[model samples]
Target chain A: MAMSSALQNGLIQLQLFEEYSWVFNLLFYVIFVVFIFYGQRIQMYVMLREVEGSLFKLKYIKDEGRKIAIETIKEIGKPQTDPAVRVDRFLEYFTIGPQSLDPAGVVWKLEHILDIRDVRFKDEVKLMAPATDDTQAHNLENTLEAAMALNFIYKIIRHFYLLGKKTLSLYIIMQIQMILPLIMREAEAYASALKAFAYGQPIGDGAGALVAAKLMRGHEIRKVPKDCVVATVPIEGRTTFVMKAEGPGGNVGKIGDAIKTVIDENEGKIATIIMIDAAMKLEGEEVGEVAEGVGAAIGGPGVDQFKIEESILKHHIPINAVIVREDIGDAVSPMRKEIFESADKAIERIKQLMLERTKEGDKVIIAGVGNSIGIGQ
Target chain B: MSKTQSNATTRISSFVLLIIFLTLALSLTALILATTFFGQGNEIIAGYLLLIGFIGVALSTYVLFQTRRRMLRLRIEIPPIVTTIECRKCGFKSVREFQRGDYIFKEGEPCQKCNEKMLITAIYREVKDKEKTA
Candidate 1:
């Protein structure tokens, strides 16, 4: 009897459902239409929302960078007036790269522009922080530069976000969303860089410089052009001239000029030119892994690489490179243990390269090519 | 900066989370109703209700996962930096939190072992392995 009664109730519910079937069908159709017409729009909204979240985070990072810059300047520079305005202005400062329409002599043009920019920046930094010494000033300048990078990143992302919102263009929104992760990663790196610069700590980029310092320690040091320094050390009976940016300050000294000078001073008789630097590692590669290759391993606007290549070619010198592998984040942030330890390994590679590539009493030039922040000669 | 914009975003996200949870609860209720209808032998009603409940659950779960990924992307944590000091005379080494003026190869306080000045030999971040998530 209980089963029969349940069957009866089921029949009644079934009938009621039939009665409301049109309502269900109508609701389904409406939903299907809405999805078909607005599916892309909905997806775009979701992406926009995600981008908005990242944008907020970027803004916070940018603001924190600015704050740190101002504080460091105030603490070290001891400026008389408030530096907030000046800091903001400096953050907005920009450099227009040299025109490439006439590609000939572009490198020199770029070098000229870079020199002027550097001079102007130093002047501005000195004016803002009169109390700071040369090293302190350079460190402060690096810190401010990081802040400026963060500021620029935030503004660019904001511009794209606003543009996408204004046009409601899915393509526009999609493009920014696709690369947002990479952009955010770079911005965060710059954010961390501010601290490294402010504290004058050795960063991963200093790997090469550290190796040079290790080699040149206790040797007679001489200053070269473009804020570079060189020391003569004997390795395996070869007179090795180790060169690096003058440091314990944040500077990737004009490496190209330094190399050129060293070669000219030696009367173009330098047997081998070996460059050491930090390189971005590929996926699955270990940090601090040392690799040797043949080329100028310096990374920048290609100016230093060009100069080094030119000088080496003119002298019929073979250029070899020993690179310590690191990631983008590692390059900017404070030095990691693995990367720091790799300096010794890089030095080992340099010594081995010299022994294999050159003979006894041969004059060799070993250039440690990277920013020399928080590293000494 | 007031950070008014970020505060607004936080509020909006919270509201969104609440709405998603409410929708999830409603979806669970619909699933319960569909099961009840199936037990009563109301196949037609059970079929429609089951479809609706399943769609709701799937959509909500997807949205929840996406929200989580966005949150994870925004999380930033800075690691601590340490300075390693080593005495040249006795090879005694010690590490401490990094000080502002500390740089590689800088001279530090006299060593406890040999009374000779310790050199700031290395400064680097204390990297920690990230925890594996299931």
Candidate 2:
């Protein structure tokens, strides 16, 4: 009778284990579904934030420039002719003037009176004017429609992201509610594993490092000592780099001079300069997604991109850019595996490129170009 | 600036004072009814009503004071004449005078002359000389 009781007890224990396993599997499936649904939505929010920030900045700049333009116009005073007559004469020029005289040039001349520079974008403005005798008749309904469509898409994506985040939070709460006791029992093991992952020595042949090296093909990679001045430039936007080499001057004109100095000083030691930056993503593109592109100069107002491009060209240096495409909505999330993978791939590619470019005594520059928010130099 | 206008202002203030007394009387009547229906004690309900009444009086008084002060400080001045250049390509033109928060040109408005969209080129307040006494 005692032997039969022992067998019954074993059977009950096995049944309990099976029941627990079934519950665990159910929870796992629910969490997986929540992650998939909300992940896309979170990405959309980040993109929106990015676009909004850029638009705000652009508007600020334009407003300031507009103020300056108005002041200049006021100082110059109106033409001697009657206001209506002057306007009439200006309109007459459009009909009778040299056909070769482009709309941009005409607008530029007008803006020149106001001492407004960079009137090249006047054509875009002109394209949106009304068809009244006093205004340009260009119908911009199509463009406005396109803009509205883009806004709608962004809103939909953001809605999804918020939904996903909420679902994830709920799932976590549910898990805690159901498995609080179990979690408490295994807390010690969980803590130790986390600690080991954080500070433990490289494991399993340094797979991460090997993956990074493979991605950085065609570039030379040399682990330089910390505090070494790899590359530096007085660029307009805030840039965070692993090793920033500070040079003289703040304006765009001095960019070439600074780059040349840095390159010359570290010639044999430094390999290629890898510039990682935030790039505006086209509509429908994923935020925080990384793309490898040939580095192009993107200087702000008064800082011409051509001048910087010319400088790099003059030095015959290959500038590779790993751009993080994001939108206006603080759309950057650390949890996105794709972003991390892309970043890793970029780093690996840069490493390989550096190794290929540099010889025995070369140095490499990896410049993380963006607003240094939540990212260390 | 004129004696006649100052007298007119005093008359308006007196009229407003009369209106406030009537509003207070009406509100007190309403509070009494509310207390009766809600089964609240006279002192407790009256205290609550008094608080609300005081706030209302304070807000109205502040608004009235501001309006009166502004009327007293009002200075009639001649408007400045301005010349503007309307863009032929886009109806975007330089307007001489615009009040704060006014849109000189809205987005996506087409130009009349060149069939281009109008973009605000300039916005400014016109400066004019005060009329001289003969």
Candidate 3:
């Protein structure tokens, strides 16, 4: 009786399958697709959670930002007791991509970028660090690298997201979706970077400080009331104050504080204030192209721009800007050969602009604005 | 900037080649499946295969259209690199396509007007925006 009933049930089931096979296939496809999508998504979040946890474990901070800078450097690549090697290693990692056609050209480019005048990078970094300690410099370099990693990851996400939204095409969306794994990898890098910054590691974005430090080499670096260091450098026979965030280990320092302090010390007797910085270029613009115009050439939070504007207006100083242009990728990622080369070109442009705008012996303030990480002052 | 032109061309041509290959393969696969289904005398399955072939054709056409539109937009998006040549002596200036081995301060061809060794005073990417008129 049981066998007969089982046979009858199998017959009925077969008849039903023939009737609803298409429905069954459709249902199976839907479930499979859903499983793939949700399963992959869950894995993505878990991966991110793991990275965040790892980054969080490597926390350290120094007076203001010393320890953070040291640990950040240690986590980024290798933490070494030798500060000089540590610093060198950290910078080498920033050039992580393809090699330049000419390494000499890259050095020439680095020189130009700093407008170093007579100062060597080694001396400058030594002066900029809290006390020329190699450990601090190493830490500083690490912090900057972390910041750059963050910038690269964020830019990638933003660039594709914007491209997809603007095009509003299914193909574009699908393409972005395909590269989500790649984006997630960049996100992991950013997590480590953010952890570094939170620990008070200085950012690589403090490029302005390095340039300023370069110009200030061979001069006495005096800490003003602000978080910045200032030095008097004569240019075209004019008294010019070059200021950068006193850095070796990492810091975008308090640029507004620096700007305000220097302007206050000058007593409204400034001829021209020229700001040189890295600017975001348009899609067609070439990396390292130099552009000159009026106003502040700073890139960051609005606070610095506001402070500079307020101080300049109060002092009745005519301010001008010279910028080295970079695309989104170049601006945030490790310094590329092209951008490094632009620094050389930017120096020439700045000299030309300063000469055209100010008379000899005119008191001027030239602020190289950016994170001064891995940069000596 | 000199690399922009070559990069765009390389990218577009490669993309075009890929689309052509895909379309050809898709068409061939669809034709083979449709013929086999028909040869098997399963008219219902043959009709379904034929329908799928038509859908493939429609998709290929849509993809081609989208690709062409993308190519045109990308062309407009990249600003042309304009090389500015200036004579150091006479200061006569002219613009041309950025040539290889050109740096901002490096000297290039002699000036047409002054016959002086002209400097590559500036190599900038300039956007020539055009307004669409109905």
Candidate 4:
């Protein structure tokens, strides 16, 4: 009997121990989940604060015109079905209309879109008084407050989700270390090409082709003169800048316009109008690689690539383009090695083309199409 | 350039770190439970740990495999287009065509009349033309 009792006790002890372990595990998992949630919440809060600060700083800048632009953009904001579509619509509105603001205008517009006005206590009280009784009014107010709170929570959660996604995307980008050297090399080549053109050194098939096309199209050309006025326009994109120069001589609107005017004034001397712009590459494209092609011109806001293209076509000029395809990031940033190498190759091509088209004395025009930000144009 | 690549590298490393963390957490919990329940000869508990480890490794391996496969499939679907030019100096014309980088021209060079130095200018689709012809 004693033996059987002891056996029962042993079995009960084992069962209790097993149950205890299970409970402990459950508690551990719960704690772990709580830790992760809290950590993420804190991270989200920090990001929100940073974004809010940037927005506030933008608002404080003394620009009434920008403020008005912002207000207008905010009023026009509607829920978009697709993110890309929304961005495109925003860009259209931001760029096309007479109301279109520059980058400063864009900053103000974003600010007004995100602005939140505080609810007045007196107004709330007045609204509550419309209720049948004090109790009812109080209840209505409470409900409204609850709804507002819920809405606020929803917005916060949405923002947190966006932040998390951005963070994850950045993390993924961090892992691909193999592509950087190529981007740098390309950026440098691009910068050097611009510099060379700015100094009036005849380089590349693109330069020559541009000259030939310009001359063919009836743009006036000049042989390398002792002192020629050269204008540089840098075409900027989402990533990189393509700097090109117009053949020397002629003062017009901006550098781009100056080049166009020069071509117009010296008609019949220019052979071709080659517009060098940054091109996006397919996946697995080598960094800083040059892809020569005849394609549509691409540029940023305020730099009218299309206008240039139209002008060229209007004059019946045969247009050729020498595009250096760099990864998106390298295109925007300036002075990498690849940009220099590509520029060198492009210049070499232009030189070869020039030798083929005209004698040593023939003048050519090359326009660097991009934003003149880092390299002082 | 360094900064951009570093960002990508850090992201991949973080993923690996996350997997390691989850595995460690799982193993630690199992160990704690095993110590509590299987007091003396815990060989069976050790076996459970081994099983969990195997499962974790398998899951991670599967994730890596899926990611690599997706990348490869994307590459095959959108291979880079290389431009080829048949410069017929005799004809005084250059015939430009889009070709795959691996494709070989009929004349073993880019010239139209006789084999001569040819430059690849642009790449576009030949498949659409072929489809139309068919």
Best by lDDT: 1
Q: lDDT for model 3, please.
A: 0.56
Which model is ahead, 1 or 2, in terms of lDDT? Answer: 1
Residue-wise C-alpha lDDT for candidate 2, range A285-327, written one tens digit per residue: 8644657666652323313234335556766667766666543
Q: Which residue segments of model 3 deviate by more than 4 Å?
A: A1-207, B1-134
TM-score ranking, best first: 1, 3, 4, 2
TM-score of each: 0.89, 0.26, 0.44, 0.36
Best by DockQ: 1
Mind giving the per-residue lDDT tens digits that candidate 3 earns over A228-316?
77899987788888877655444455566677787787787888888878787776676567788898777653546767888888878
- Which candidate number would show the highest TM-score if scored against the true structure? 1
Task: List per-prediction Cα lDDT, in the order shown.
Answer: 0.88, 0.37, 0.56, 0.39
Q: Total clashing residue pairs per candidate?
A: 0, 67, 19, 72
Ranking of all candidate structures by their DockQ, best first: 1, 3, 4, 2
Interface RMSD of 2: 31.7
- For model 1, residues A1-377, the per-residue Cα lDDT tens digits are 99999789878877897898899799999999999999999999999987998898898788878888999999999999998988988988989999999899999999999989999999989988989999999999999999999999999999999999999999999999999988987998897788889989899998999999999998999999989999999988999999999999999998899999989998899999999999999767888999999999999989889998899889999889999998888899889899988988888888889889999999999999888999987
TM-score pick, better of 1 and 4: 1
Task: Evaluate candidate 2 by giving its C-alpha RMSD to the native, one decimal.
Answer: 27.7
- lDDT tens digits by residue: candidate 2, B62-88: 757765664543321222222233564
